[model samples]
Target: MGVDGVFVAEPVSNVLGGLACLLTMYVTVYRRLGR
Candidate 1:
């Protein structure tokens, strides 16, 4: 159960973190280019 929990949690956390990072980067670049 613990192993399964870790497996599920790790991917979910990584995906969220990656998306957040990508969104921030995209916004920053878009603003810079817009200006």
Candidate 2:
């Protein structure tokens, strides 16, 4: 159970991290374009 939980949690955290990185890049581009 613990190992299964770790596997599930790892993907979720990775996805969240990926989304955060994409969001940061999008905002940076938007700001640059806005300027």
Candidate 3:
């Protein structure tokens, strides 16, 4: 990752993973609240 072109894909993967995690947490909380 040291100045290599491979580092370009980092942001995309991070955004995707973050969105997935956020959605999962939202669903979990909603289910627990029963709303």
Please give the lDDT score at residue 15 for candidate 1: 99
Pick the winner on TM-score between candidates 1 and 2.
Answer: 2
Candidate 2 per-residue lDDT, tens place, 1-35, comes to 69999999999999999999999999999999999
| lDDT scores of the candidates, listed in order | 0.98, 0.98, 0.88
Cα RMSD for candidates in order: 1.3, 1.0, 3.1
TM-score of model 2 (CA atoms): 0.90
Model 1 poorest 10 in a row by lDDT = 1-10
Clashing pairs in 1: none
Question: Which candidate achieves the best TM-score against the true structure?
Answer: 2
The TM-score of predicted model 1 comes to 0.82
Residue lDDT tens for model 3, 1-35 = 56555676788889999999999999999999996
Over 1-35, each residue of candidate 1 has an lDDT whose tens digit, in order, gives: 68999999999999999999999999999999999
- As for model 3, its CA RMSD to the true structure in angstroms is 3.1
